[model samples]
Target: MDERKIRVVVAKPGLDGHDRGAKVVARALRDAGMEVVYTGLRQTPEQIVETVLQEDADAVGISILSGAHTFYFTKIIGLLKEKDAGDIIVFGGGVIPDKDIPGLLEAGAGAVFGPGTPTSVCVEWLEKAVADKRAKEQ
Candidate 1:
Protein backbone atom coordinates (compact mmCIF):
# COMPACT_ATOMS: atom_id res chain seq x y z
CA MET A 1 0.00 0.00 0.00
CA ASP A 2 1.22 3.47 -0.82
CA GLU A 3 1.63 5.51 2.31
CA ARG A 4 -0.38 8.71 2.31
CA LYS A 5 -0.79 11.29 4.99
CA ILE A 6 -4.27 11.31 6.49
CA ARG A 7 -6.38 14.31 5.56
CA VAL A 8 -8.75 15.75 8.12
CA VAL A 9 -11.23 18.59 8.21
CA VAL A 10 -11.72 20.27 11.55
CA ALA A 11 -14.93 22.26 11.78
CA LYS A 12 -16.95 24.19 14.28
CA PRO A 13 -20.60 23.63 13.43
CA GLY A 14 -23.12 25.79 15.20
CA LEU A 15 -23.36 29.19 16.86
CA ASP A 16 -20.58 28.55 19.29
CA GLY A 17 -17.80 31.10 19.15
CA HIS A 18 -15.17 29.30 21.20
CA ASP A 19 -12.51 27.86 18.92
CA ARG A 20 -9.40 27.46 21.03
CA GLY A 21 -9.94 23.73 21.24
CA ALA A 22 -10.64 23.33 17.56
CA LYS A 23 -7.53 25.24 16.62
CA VAL A 24 -5.51 23.27 19.08
CA VAL A 25 -6.75 19.95 17.74
CA ALA A 26 -6.09 21.03 14.16
CA ARG A 27 -2.56 21.96 15.05
CA ALA A 28 -2.11 18.71 16.85
CA LEU A 29 -3.20 16.77 13.81
CA ARG A 30 -0.83 18.73 11.63
CA ASP A 31 2.02 18.17 14.04
CA ALA A 32 1.25 14.49 13.88
CA GLY A 33 1.93 14.61 10.12
CA MET A 34 -1.63 14.75 8.90
CA GLU A 35 -3.11 17.40 6.65
CA VAL A 36 -5.62 19.52 8.54
CA VAL A 37 -8.14 21.91 7.11
CA TYR A 38 -9.94 24.06 9.61
CA THR A 39 -13.33 25.49 8.56
CA GLY A 40 -13.30 28.18 11.24
CA LEU A 41 -16.35 28.97 13.38
CA ARG A 42 -20.14 28.95 13.09
CA GLN A 43 -20.32 26.62 10.08
CA THR A 44 -23.55 24.86 9.20
CA PRO A 45 -23.65 21.12 8.60
CA GLU A 46 -23.96 21.47 4.85
CA GLN A 47 -20.93 23.73 4.75
CA ILE A 48 -18.90 21.29 6.77
CA VAL A 49 -19.82 18.34 4.58
CA GLU A 50 -19.03 20.38 1.50
CA THR A 51 -15.59 21.16 2.88
CA VAL A 52 -15.03 17.49 3.58
CA LEU A 53 -15.96 16.54 0.03
CA GLN A 54 -13.81 19.28 -1.44
CA GLU A 55 -10.87 18.33 0.70
CA ASP A 56 -11.43 14.63 0.07
CA ALA A 57 -10.91 14.22 3.79
CA ASP A 58 -10.44 10.87 5.38
CA ALA A 59 -12.19 12.11 8.49
CA VAL A 60 -13.94 15.08 10.05
CA GLY A 61 -13.51 16.45 13.55
CA ILE A 62 -16.25 18.71 14.88
CA SER A 63 -15.77 20.89 17.91
CA ILE A 64 -18.99 22.06 19.51
CA LEU A 65 -19.79 23.71 22.79
CA SER A 66 -23.22 25.11 22.06
CA GLY A 67 -25.01 22.19 23.70
CA ALA A 68 -26.52 21.32 20.34
CA HIS A 69 -24.18 18.44 19.57
CA THR A 70 -27.01 16.02 18.94
CA PHE A 71 -28.65 18.18 16.32
CA TYR A 72 -25.48 19.26 14.58
CA PHE A 73 -23.87 15.82 14.59
CA THR A 74 -26.99 14.08 13.39
CA LYS A 75 -27.42 16.51 10.54
CA ILE A 76 -23.76 16.28 9.54
CA ILE A 77 -23.82 12.50 9.58
CA GLY A 78 -27.06 12.41 7.62
CA LEU A 79 -25.66 14.75 5.03
CA LEU A 80 -22.53 12.62 4.64
CA LYS A 81 -24.72 9.57 4.11
CA GLU A 82 -26.84 11.37 1.58
CA LYS A 83 -23.71 12.40 -0.26
CA ASP A 84 -22.54 8.78 -0.16
CA ALA A 85 -19.53 9.87 1.83
CA GLY A 86 -20.37 8.09 5.01
CA ASP A 87 -17.05 6.26 4.86
CA ILE A 88 -15.48 9.51 5.97
CA ILE A 89 -15.09 9.05 9.68
CA VAL A 90 -16.69 11.60 11.99
CA PHE A 91 -15.60 12.45 15.52
CA GLY A 92 -16.54 15.19 17.95
CA GLY A 93 -15.27 17.05 20.95
CA GLY A 94 -16.49 19.78 23.29
CA VAL A 95 -18.47 20.13 26.47
CA ILE A 96 -20.42 17.01 25.60
CA PRO A 97 -21.89 15.25 28.56
CA ASP A 98 -21.03 11.64 29.33
CA LYS A 99 -24.63 10.63 28.92
CA ASP A 100 -24.70 11.98 25.40
CA ILE A 101 -21.58 10.18 24.21
CA PRO A 102 -23.37 6.97 23.40
CA GLY A 103 -26.05 8.77 21.46
CA LEU A 104 -23.44 10.67 19.51
CA LEU A 105 -21.71 7.41 18.60
CA GLU A 106 -25.02 5.87 17.66
CA ALA A 107 -25.65 8.91 15.51
CA GLY A 108 -22.57 7.93 13.45
CA ALA A 109 -19.79 9.68 15.32
CA GLY A 110 -16.80 7.36 15.60
CA ALA A 111 -15.73 8.95 18.87
CA VAL A 112 -16.43 11.81 21.25
CA PHE A 113 -13.88 13.69 23.29
CA GLY A 114 -15.00 15.66 26.27
CA PRO A 115 -13.28 18.64 27.82
CA GLY A 116 -9.70 18.07 29.01
CA THR A 117 -9.03 15.34 26.48
CA PRO A 118 -5.36 15.27 25.61
CA THR A 119 -4.53 16.32 22.09
CA SER A 120 -2.36 13.25 21.74
CA VAL A 121 -5.34 11.01 22.31
CA CYS A 122 -7.21 12.64 19.45
CA VAL A 123 -4.13 12.34 17.26
CA GLU A 124 -3.70 8.70 18.17
CA TRP A 125 -7.31 7.91 17.44
CA LEU A 126 -7.14 9.59 14.08
CA GLU A 127 -3.98 7.74 13.16
CA LYS A 128 -5.51 4.40 14.02
CA ALA A 129 -8.90 5.11 12.53
CA VAL A 130 -7.48 6.38 9.27
CA ALA A 131 -5.17 3.40 8.99
CA ASP A 132 -8.04 1.04 9.65
CA LYS A 133 -10.16 2.78 7.06
CA ARG A 134 -7.41 2.58 4.49
CA ALA A 135 -6.89 -1.07 5.20
CA LYS A 136 -10.56 -1.73 4.64
CA GLU A 137 -10.51 0.20 1.37
CA GLN A 138 -7.76 -2.04 0.09
Candidate 2:
Protein backbone atom coordinates (compact mmCIF):
# COMPACT_ATOMS: atom_id res chain seq x y z
CA MET A 1 0.00 0.00 0.00
CA ASP A 2 2.97 2.30 0.31
CA GLU A 3 4.46 4.21 -2.57
CA ARG A 4 7.37 1.78 -2.85
CA LYS A 5 6.87 -1.04 -5.32
CA ILE A 6 7.21 -4.64 -4.21
CA ARG A 7 10.50 -6.17 -5.27
CA VAL A 8 10.62 -9.79 -6.42
CA VAL A 9 13.53 -11.85 -7.64
CA VAL A 10 12.67 -14.46 -10.28
CA ALA A 11 15.33 -17.11 -10.68
CA LYS A 12 16.04 -20.38 -12.42
CA PRO A 13 18.18 -22.72 -10.35
CA GLY A 14 20.23 -25.78 -11.21
CA LEU A 15 20.76 -27.29 -14.66
CA ASP A 16 17.41 -26.31 -16.04
CA GLY A 17 18.01 -25.12 -19.57
CA HIS A 18 14.44 -24.05 -20.21
CA ASP A 19 13.55 -20.62 -18.90
CA ARG A 20 10.36 -19.74 -20.76
CA GLY A 21 8.18 -20.02 -17.68
CA ALA A 22 10.52 -17.94 -15.56
CA LYS A 23 10.60 -15.22 -18.16
CA VAL A 24 6.85 -15.22 -18.49
CA VAL A 25 6.32 -14.91 -14.77
CA ALA A 26 8.93 -12.20 -14.44
CA ARG A 27 7.27 -10.15 -17.14
CA ALA A 28 3.88 -10.71 -15.55
CA LEU A 29 5.12 -9.49 -12.19
CA ARG A 30 6.60 -6.45 -13.83
CA ASP A 31 3.40 -5.81 -15.75
CA ALA A 32 1.53 -5.99 -12.45
CA GLY A 33 3.62 -3.05 -11.24
CA MET A 34 6.15 -4.92 -9.13
CA GLU A 35 9.86 -4.47 -9.57
CA VAL A 36 11.05 -7.83 -10.83
CA VAL A 37 14.67 -8.86 -11.02
CA TYR A 38 15.26 -11.95 -13.12
CA THR A 39 18.45 -13.81 -12.17
CA GLY A 40 18.75 -15.48 -15.58
CA LEU A 41 19.20 -19.23 -16.04
CA ARG A 42 21.10 -21.98 -14.22
CA GLN A 43 21.73 -20.17 -10.93
CA THR A 44 22.87 -21.69 -7.70
CA PRO A 45 21.02 -21.23 -4.45
CA GLU A 46 23.89 -19.12 -3.13
CA GLN A 47 23.77 -16.80 -6.12
CA ILE A 48 20.03 -16.40 -5.87
CA VAL A 49 20.23 -15.68 -2.17
CA GLU A 50 22.98 -13.18 -2.70
CA THR A 51 20.88 -11.42 -5.31
CA VAL A 52 17.97 -11.31 -2.89
CA LEU A 53 20.18 -9.75 -0.28
CA GLN A 54 21.68 -7.25 -2.66
CA GLU A 55 18.31 -6.30 -4.11
CA ASP A 56 16.59 -6.18 -0.73
CA ALA A 57 13.85 -8.28 -2.30
CA ASP A 58 10.63 -8.91 -0.46
CA ALA A 59 10.02 -12.23 -2.22
CA VAL A 60 11.75 -14.79 -4.44
CA GLY A 61 9.98 -16.82 -7.12
CA ILE A 62 11.94 -19.75 -8.50
CA SER A 63 11.21 -21.70 -11.68
CA ILE A 64 12.47 -25.26 -11.75
CA LEU A 65 11.74 -27.75 -14.50
CA SER A 66 14.58 -30.19 -13.86
CA GLY A 67 12.82 -32.16 -11.13
CA ALA A 68 15.19 -30.89 -8.46
CA HIS A 69 12.70 -28.55 -6.87
CA THR A 70 12.96 -30.17 -3.46
CA PHE A 71 16.70 -30.01 -3.24
CA TYR A 72 17.18 -26.54 -4.72
CA PHE A 73 14.22 -25.00 -2.92
CA THR A 74 15.19 -26.44 0.44
CA LYS A 75 18.75 -25.28 -0.07
CA ILE A 76 17.68 -21.76 -0.91
CA ILE A 77 15.34 -21.62 2.08
CA GLY A 78 18.03 -23.02 4.34
CA LEU A 79 20.56 -20.53 3.07
CA LEU A 80 18.11 -17.70 3.62
CA LYS A 81 17.58 -18.80 7.19
CA GLU A 82 21.26 -19.32 7.71
CA LYS A 83 21.91 -15.81 6.50
CA ASP A 84 19.11 -14.53 8.78
CA ALA A 85 16.99 -13.59 5.79
CA GLY A 86 14.15 -16.01 6.30
CA ASP A 87 11.68 -13.17 6.16
CA ILE A 88 11.93 -13.22 2.39
CA ILE A 89 8.98 -15.04 0.86
CA VAL A 90 9.85 -18.02 -1.35
CA PHE A 91 7.59 -19.54 -4.01
CA GLY A 92 8.18 -21.90 -6.91
CA GLY A 93 6.64 -23.41 -10.03
CA GLY A 94 7.29 -25.68 -13.05
CA VAL A 95 6.98 -29.45 -13.37
CA ILE A 96 6.18 -29.82 -9.67
CA PRO A 97 4.10 -32.82 -8.67
CA ASP A 98 0.98 -32.49 -6.57
CA LYS A 99 2.40 -34.77 -3.90
CA ASP A 100 5.57 -32.73 -3.77
CA ILE A 101 3.76 -29.47 -3.09
CA PRO A 102 3.07 -30.22 0.58
CA GLY A 103 6.68 -31.17 1.16
CA LEU A 104 7.83 -28.03 -0.64
CA LEU A 105 5.62 -25.88 1.56
CA GLU A 106 6.82 -27.70 4.66
CA ALA A 107 10.37 -27.11 3.52
CA GLY A 108 9.58 -23.35 3.48
CA ALA A 109 7.98 -22.50 0.14
CA GLY A 110 5.19 -20.01 0.52
CA ALA A 111 3.38 -21.54 -2.48
CA VAL A 112 3.97 -23.63 -5.59
CA PHE A 113 2.18 -23.26 -8.89
CA GLY A 114 1.93 -26.09 -11.26
CA PRO A 115 1.33 -25.91 -15.02
CA GLY A 116 -1.55 -23.79 -16.33
CA THR A 117 -1.66 -21.35 -13.44
CA PRO A 118 -2.71 -17.92 -14.60
CA THR A 119 -0.30 -15.03 -14.39
CA SER A 120 -2.95 -12.98 -12.64
CA VAL A 121 -3.07 -15.55 -9.84
CA CYS A 122 0.65 -15.22 -9.34
CA VAL A 123 0.52 -11.43 -9.43
CA GLU A 124 -2.35 -11.29 -6.95
CA TRP A 125 -0.66 -13.70 -4.61
CA LEU A 126 2.57 -11.77 -4.63
CA GLU A 127 0.73 -8.53 -4.02
CA LYS A 128 -1.07 -9.84 -0.94
CA ALA A 129 1.94 -11.75 0.32
CA VAL A 130 4.23 -8.75 0.09
CA ALA A 131 1.70 -6.44 1.65
CA ASP A 132 1.10 -8.81 4.54
CA LYS A 133 4.81 -9.28 5.09
CA ARG A 134 5.48 -5.55 5.13
CA ALA A 135 2.55 -4.93 7.40
CA LYS A 136 3.74 -7.51 9.86
CA GLU A 137 7.21 -5.98 9.87
CA GLN A 138 5.69 -2.63 10.74
Candidate 3:
Protein backbone atom coordinates (compact mmCIF):
# COMPACT_ATOMS: atom_id res chain seq x y z
CA MET A 1 0.00 0.00 0.00
CA ASP A 2 2.98 2.29 -0.24
CA GLU A 3 3.34 3.83 -3.68
CA ARG A 4 0.42 1.91 -5.09
CA LYS A 5 -2.84 3.82 -5.05
CA ILE A 6 -5.83 2.47 -3.15
CA ARG A 7 -8.53 1.81 -5.71
CA VAL A 8 -12.20 1.41 -4.85
CA VAL A 9 -15.41 0.88 -6.77
CA VAL A 10 -18.43 2.79 -5.50
CA ALA A 11 -21.79 1.44 -6.61
CA LYS A 12 -25.47 2.01 -6.15
CA PRO A 13 -27.11 -1.39 -5.89
CA GLY A 14 -30.67 -2.70 -6.19
CA LEU A 15 -33.67 -0.51 -7.07
CA ASP A 16 -32.23 2.38 -5.17
CA GLY A 17 -32.37 5.32 -7.54
CA HIS A 18 -30.72 7.71 -5.12
CA ASP A 19 -27.00 8.22 -5.67
CA ARG A 20 -26.16 11.63 -4.27
CA GLY A 21 -24.44 10.13 -1.29
CA ALA A 22 -22.49 7.72 -3.39
CA LYS A 23 -21.19 10.47 -5.65
CA VAL A 24 -20.19 12.62 -2.71
CA VAL A 25 -18.30 9.78 -1.09
CA ALA A 26 -16.61 8.99 -4.35
CA ARG A 27 -15.44 12.56 -4.70
CA ALA A 28 -14.11 12.55 -1.16
CA LEU A 29 -12.15 9.38 -1.79
CA ARG A 30 -10.73 10.82 -4.98
CA ASP A 31 -9.84 14.03 -3.18
CA ALA A 32 -8.07 11.94 -0.58
CA GLY A 33 -5.84 10.49 -3.32
CA MET A 34 -7.60 7.18 -3.93
CA GLU A 35 -8.73 5.87 -7.27
CA VAL A 36 -12.53 5.69 -7.34
CA VAL A 37 -14.86 4.29 -9.92
CA TYR A 38 -18.48 5.36 -9.43
CA THR A 39 -20.93 2.82 -10.79
CA GLY A 40 -24.11 4.77 -11.17
CA LEU A 41 -27.64 3.92 -10.00
CA ARG A 42 -29.66 0.71 -10.30
CA GLN A 43 -26.85 -1.83 -10.32
CA THR A 44 -27.46 -5.49 -9.68
CA PRO A 45 -25.31 -7.31 -7.15
CA GLU A 46 -23.70 -9.38 -9.87
CA GLN A 47 -22.88 -6.29 -11.92
CA ILE A 48 -21.28 -4.55 -8.95
CA VAL A 49 -19.11 -7.55 -8.24
CA GLU A 50 -18.06 -7.69 -11.86
CA THR A 51 -17.09 -4.03 -11.87
CA VAL A 52 -15.08 -4.48 -8.69
CA LEU A 53 -13.19 -7.40 -10.14
CA GLN A 54 -12.67 -5.69 -13.47
CA GLU A 55 -11.36 -2.56 -11.82
CA ASP A 56 -9.12 -4.59 -9.52
CA ALA A 57 -10.35 -2.53 -6.62
CA ASP A 58 -9.24 -3.01 -3.06
CA ALA A 59 -12.79 -2.42 -1.82
CA VAL A 60 -16.36 -1.61 -2.85
CA GLY A 61 -18.73 0.91 -1.34
CA ILE A 62 -22.37 0.20 -2.09
CA SER A 63 -25.12 2.78 -1.66
CA ILE A 64 -28.67 1.54 -1.45
CA LEU A 65 -31.72 3.52 -0.52
CA SER A 66 -34.14 0.66 -1.06
CA GLY A 67 -35.37 -1.65 1.67
CA ALA A 68 -33.50 -4.50 0.04
CA HIS A 69 -30.22 -3.98 1.85
CA THR A 70 -30.22 -7.52 3.19
CA PHE A 71 -30.78 -9.07 -0.19
CA TYR A 72 -28.21 -6.94 -2.01
CA PHE A 73 -25.51 -7.34 0.64
CA THR A 74 -26.03 -11.07 0.89
CA LYS A 75 -26.02 -11.52 -2.86
CA ILE A 76 -22.93 -9.35 -3.46
CA ILE A 77 -20.93 -10.95 -0.66
CA GLY A 78 -21.97 -14.42 -1.67
CA LEU A 79 -21.07 -13.71 -5.27
CA LEU A 80 -17.63 -12.47 -4.29
CA LYS A 81 -17.06 -15.56 -2.21
CA GLU A 82 -18.22 -17.74 -5.05
CA LYS A 83 -15.79 -16.00 -7.42
CA ASP A 84 -12.98 -16.47 -4.88
CA ALA A 85 -12.67 -12.69 -4.53
CA GLY A 86 -13.68 -12.35 -0.92
CA ASP A 87 -10.61 -10.25 -0.23
CA ILE A 88 -12.34 -7.22 -1.78
CA ILE A 89 -13.67 -5.43 1.26
CA VAL A 90 -17.37 -4.53 1.18
CA PHE A 91 -18.95 -1.47 2.76
CA GLY A 92 -22.38 0.11 2.45
CA GLY A 93 -24.31 3.33 2.97
CA GLY A 94 -27.79 4.90 2.67
CA VAL A 95 -31.24 4.70 4.26
CA ILE A 96 -30.61 1.43 6.05
CA PRO A 97 -32.10 0.90 9.46
CA ASP A 98 -29.93 0.69 12.56
CA LYS A 99 -31.33 -2.76 13.30
CA ASP A 100 -30.03 -3.99 9.98
CA ILE A 101 -26.44 -2.93 10.64
CA PRO A 102 -25.45 -6.06 12.52
CA GLY A 103 -27.02 -8.28 9.90
CA LEU A 104 -25.21 -6.46 7.09
CA LEU A 105 -21.92 -6.88 8.93
CA GLU A 106 -22.64 -10.57 9.40
CA ALA A 107 -23.48 -10.72 5.72
CA GLY A 108 -19.91 -9.45 5.09
CA ALA A 109 -20.15 -5.64 4.99
CA GLY A 110 -17.00 -4.18 6.52
CA ALA A 111 -19.00 -1.11 7.59
CA VAL A 112 -22.37 0.58 7.15
CA PHE A 113 -22.94 4.33 7.11
CA GLY A 114 -26.39 5.61 7.87
CA PRO A 115 -27.87 8.93 6.78
CA GLY A 116 -25.99 12.03 7.99
CA THR A 117 -22.65 10.26 8.06
CA PRO A 118 -19.94 12.61 6.85
CA THR A 119 -18.15 11.80 3.62
CA SER A 120 -14.89 12.52 5.40
CA VAL A 121 -15.65 9.78 7.88
CA CYS A 122 -16.23 7.31 5.07
CA VAL A 123 -13.01 8.37 3.42
CA GLU A 124 -11.03 7.96 6.65
CA TRP A 125 -12.53 4.57 7.40
CA LEU A 126 -11.92 3.32 3.88
CA GLU A 127 -8.29 4.46 3.99
CA LYS A 128 -7.63 2.56 7.20
CA ALA A 129 -9.63 -0.49 6.17
CA VAL A 130 -7.87 -0.78 2.83
CA ALA A 131 -4.48 -0.29 4.46
CA ASP A 132 -5.20 -3.00 7.00
CA LYS A 133 -6.39 -5.33 4.29
CA ARG A 134 -3.26 -4.74 2.22
CA ALA A 135 -1.06 -5.37 5.23
CA LYS A 136 -2.81 -8.65 5.91
CA GLU A 137 -2.42 -9.69 2.30
CA GLN A 138 1.34 -9.36 2.63
Q: Which residue pairs show collisions in model 3? A: none
Q: Report lDDT (Cα) of residue 122, candidate 2.
A: 93
Runs in model 2 lying further than 4 Å from the true structure = none
Candidate 3 local Cα displacement, residue 47, angstroms: 1.0
State the lDDT of candidate 3 residue by residue for 1-138, as single tens digits.
356899999999877788888899999999999999999888888899999999999999988887888889899999999999998999988889999999999988999999998888888898889889888888
Better candidate number, 2 or 3, judged by TM-score: 2
CA lDDT of 66 in candidate 2?
A: 88
All candidates: CA RMSD (Å): 0.8, 0.7, 1.0
For model 3, the run of ten residues with the poorest summed lDDT: 1-10
Clash number for each model:
0, 0, 0
lDDT of 2 by residue, 1-138 (tens): 567899999999998988999999999999999999999987999999999999999999999998999999999999999999999999989999999999999999999999999999999998998889999988
TM-score versus the correct structure, for each prediction: 0.98, 0.98, 0.96
> Which residues of candidate 3, in runs, are more than 4 Å off?
none
* C-alpha lDDT (0 to 100) for residue 18 of candidate 3: 88
lDDT of 1 at 14: 86
**How many times do residue backbones clash in model 2?**
0
